[model samples]
Target chain A: MGPEVMPLLENRNDIDLVLWQQDCACDRKWFLENVQGATAIIVMFGDKVDSELFEAAGPQLRVVSTMSVGYDHIDVKEISKRKIKLGYTPDVLSDAVADICIMLALMAGRNARESMAVVNEGKWPNYSWAPFLFCGRQLSSTATSQRTVGFIGFGRIAHATLARLIPFGYTHCLYLANPSSAPATARDAALAAQHHLQSVQRVDADTLAATSDVVFVLAPGGAATEHLVGARFLRRMKPTAVLVNASRGTLVDSDALATALRERWIWGAGLDVVTGEPNIAADHPLVKEPRCVVVPHIGSATIETRIDMATLAVNNALAAIAGEAMPASVEF
Target chain B: MGPEVMPLLENRNDIDLVLWQQDCACDRKWFLENVQGATAIIVMFGDKVDSELFEAAGPQLRVVSTMSVGYDHIDVKEISKRKIKLGYTPDVLSDAVADICIMLALMAGRNARESMAVVNEGKWPNYSWAPFLFCGRQLSSTATSQRTVGFIGFGRIAHATLARLIPFGYTHCLYLANPSSAPATARDAALAAQHHLQSVQRVDADTLAATSDVVFVLAPGGAATEHLVGARFLRRMKPTAVLVNASRGTLVDSDALATALRERWIWGAGLDVVTGEPNIAADHPLVKEPRCVVVPHIGSATIETRIDMATLAVNNALAAIAGEAMPASVEF
Candidate 1:
């Protein structure tokens, strides 16, 4: 815990806190031994919150609060079955993640990675300033004509991203929402009018893939969303369009996107996440693709954002232990 | 010339066009041999416009149109003395350069270069996800508190940059305009109201350096502005602050800024231009600084912006040849 969160937890006579203090991942043996008699546990993305861990924690375990927005590491079904309250930090991180999405989009479209490589390789002096050299697509629309921005999932982060793009002249927004969710025409119209955009419409995947100048994948990671942006979707995208994935790596088919870039089917891609993250070697196909600007998952890595997340996680754990509702809790 | 510009010049019965076909710089010998009776010459940054070039054109050169915003390469005094019209592309590139300024600020503050390097080096798997690792300063003001952004030179590009930062919750703006220009109190008040800012004031250089969270150098390159951001100015800046220069390389003392970064005097710096042209070697002090996110001089190297600049340059040359007012002529 940071100094900010330590104040909230320290000198609490009612509760005993046992922190897995090492910077490295908490050893499984250490976790199992120390988790005994604990009423609640605070976890991170690295921890596996499965039935095995729950069995060791005993029936006294009332809550499992994760210091992240994504709970893919947790076994939600088992937690729900036991009626243990679950809390995952969300909304608080939307701004930070949205900021990175814009950065990636600009980096990919502007060829920042390749251009910086030229400077780092000591070849800039020899490279002549040609009229067309190192030129990439513009993020902002210069002309009066509309620029289209599309989203795979119109969630909180997607909405925040759209808000940022408004100033850049992204007049047309097309998003594919959850099929079960009701149409948000009235809301979309209000947003469009507020930002003075041409339109904001809920569209099908095919239309979004074909017409968007920039495509952002902000959908959740699961079997349903796995490989959502595959060969068929890549083939339909505009040749000049940029693809940015700041959400989950599994949403994109890495090999297909790599082929799209290699074959010049798309301008470029900016990705913060990949299918097998941390384990993605330097020789990974996406890493070797010159048109791709890949960064390690750092969507919410800003100092302020991380502290907010940590504080919220601590607050949620404390609330659940007090037999009260968490400020942000999973519906289940 | 690109394929788009070729149509504008090709097959013109009135004017014979001699092309410098190679991607490399035009040979000085070839330039002199062919320039005996040229009415107007379109030049790039690489070509020097001096008394020698004016004499080679043999008193017939009516205009020298550069396809760039900066005319530091042109001898303006000599061009004015010879009564030659000088045209430069300026406003058309402001949006592109402003976009790059924001990119650099975020990149430098967020350690994009260094963090990406970790992934590229295949060391990510070995590194643990610590609470404080890879965290950098936040670009946005998360709470309802104020964040100040300072500008070294408040010009078209500076205003555009300020417009972008408003959405990021920058509540106050401080700028140091040219000393001779009157303080824009009324105009600044109107701007502050329009952007919902606390204030937008014209302040002294020292105050700007001391209070700004992000200081942008958007001044022109000339003897007056040379080394404007050196050790004395840097010493007053907050250690958490970021310095971004997308305008002119000469506005900053590269060695001073590099030392500041190395010694942790400031948070980081993002520079598009350096002291030298295309000659910043790998061993260059600024390039070697880990806190600096350095790129080749590509502030306006977007496909749309470059095309517009080239088209405007061609139009200015044609206009000068026709003895009409050039679209963007510099007054002597």
Candidate 2:
């Protein structure tokens, strides 16, 4: 565990704490042995919470708290069957992730990666200042006649992202609501009125792809959203549109988006998450694409947000161990 | 000139157009020879409009319209003496420059250059996702207790930048106004109410630097503001504060900023303009600072803005030639 969460677990007299002290990943053998007889376990994104680990912890383990919003690494089925309470940080990270979403959108649209690379490679001296050199698509609606911002998901993070765009004179907001949810006409109307947007409508994927000058992938990652922004979606997008992915890596197809960028199907892309993260090779197709600005999985890497998440995770574990309700429990 | 403005200059029956048909700088001899017997001369940022050029034009030079906002390159004193109407594109590019200001602030606060460089250097596979690794200061006020945004000059571009920050929850606005202007008590109050900000006040340079979470150097470039953000000002800033320059390069001392960043006196900086630009070496102190994100002067380098500037320059010159007031004339 990081030092941010260390103080919370240090002075507890009623409970014992075992931490993986090194910066590297904890040894599986060590984790299995240390988790024995523990009433609760705190895990991060890389640690898999499964039946094998739960069985090793015996019937005494009552809860599992993760310092992340995504629980894809956790086997929900096994935890549900065991009636183990699960706590995951959610709303605390929305602001940080939304901030990065806008950052990536601006970076990708403004050609920051390539332009900065030119400076870093010592090429600025030879480059002349022409009217058109390094010109990029403007993010604000002030310069454009019409600006449409589209989102794949309209949850907390999406709303936050929309709020940021409104000040930039984004006139229209289009989003694809979850299939399971009812129509969001009232919600859209309320948002439009509050932000003074031209209109906010829930549209079909095709319309969202075709009309949006900038598209944001803010959906969850899993089987339901795997490759949601593949070749078909890319092909339908405006040639001047910019795509930003700050949600989950799996929602986008790396190769397809790369090809789309190279072929000029879309203007550019800014990405924080990729299909396979931490392992994203330097020669990955998305990284190799000049129009693509790729970063490691750092959507919620802000200092304040990470500290808040750790504090919440520690408090949730403490509450569970004390036979009290967790502050942010994930319902089965 | 690029294709965007060619149509405006083409097919003019009554006008004689002398085109400098090369990508390189216009030769001095060619410019002097061609400018003679010319009624108007359209210039760019690097083209100097001095007494010698004015004399060479032989009283036929009715106007000098530059395709840029900055007139530091032009000899305004000589132009005024010769009664040459001066035109420059100002408000047209404010949106573009403002957009880049916000981009740099977010980029600096988020460690984009260094983090992206890590990925580009083939080091991602070896880097682990730690809770604190590459963690940066959050740009939004939502994550911060009290967010303060300060500006050295609060003119069109600065206000445009402030508008972009409102959605990010920047509650307080502080700026160092021009010394000649009256105290903006009523104006600041009106602006505060209009923007729904906590307060908007004109403060001193020291207070602006000390309290601002992000400081923007947006004042004009010249002797009056040279090295305004030097070591003393940088030392007064919060260790977590970020400095952004989208206005004039001469307003900031590059060496001071580099030293501040290296010594951890300031968190980071984002510069769109720097002193002695286009000639800035790759080994320059500011360029070598890991915390500094340096881009070639591209504050107004957006397709829409550039086209608008070029069109405005052409129209201003044509209007002057026709014995009419230029659209955006700079009064002597």
Question: What is the iRMS for every candidate structure?
Answer: 1.2, 1.7
Per-residue lDDT of candidate 2, residues B1-332 (tens digit): 67878778886888889888876556778888889988999988878889989988999789999999889889888999989899999899988888899889988998988888777666788886667778888888655477999999988899889988888888999999889988879988888998899999999999999999999888887788899899999999999999999888999988889899999999999999888878877798988998999888888887888899999999999999999889998997
Instruction: For all candidates, state DockQ relative to the true structure.
Output: 0.70, 0.66
Q: Name the 10 consecutive residues with the lowest summed lDDT in model 1 chain B.
A: B137-146
Model 1 lDDT tens row, B1-332: 68877677775789988878887777888988887798989888878889998898888889999999889889989999999999999888887888888888888878899888888878778877766678888777776456899999998889888988887778999999889898788989988998899999999989999999999999888898999999999999999899999988999999899999999999999999998868989999988988898888888898888888988999999999999988998898
User: Candidate 1: what's its TM-score on chain B?
Assistant: 0.97
Off by over 4 Å in 2: A1-4, B23-25
Q: Quick one: best lDDT, which candidate?
A: 1
lDDT of 1: 0.88
lDDT, each prediction: 0.88, 0.88
- What RMSD does model 2 have? 1.5
Please, what is the TM-score per model? 0.98, 0.97
Error of 1 at A131 (Å): 0.8
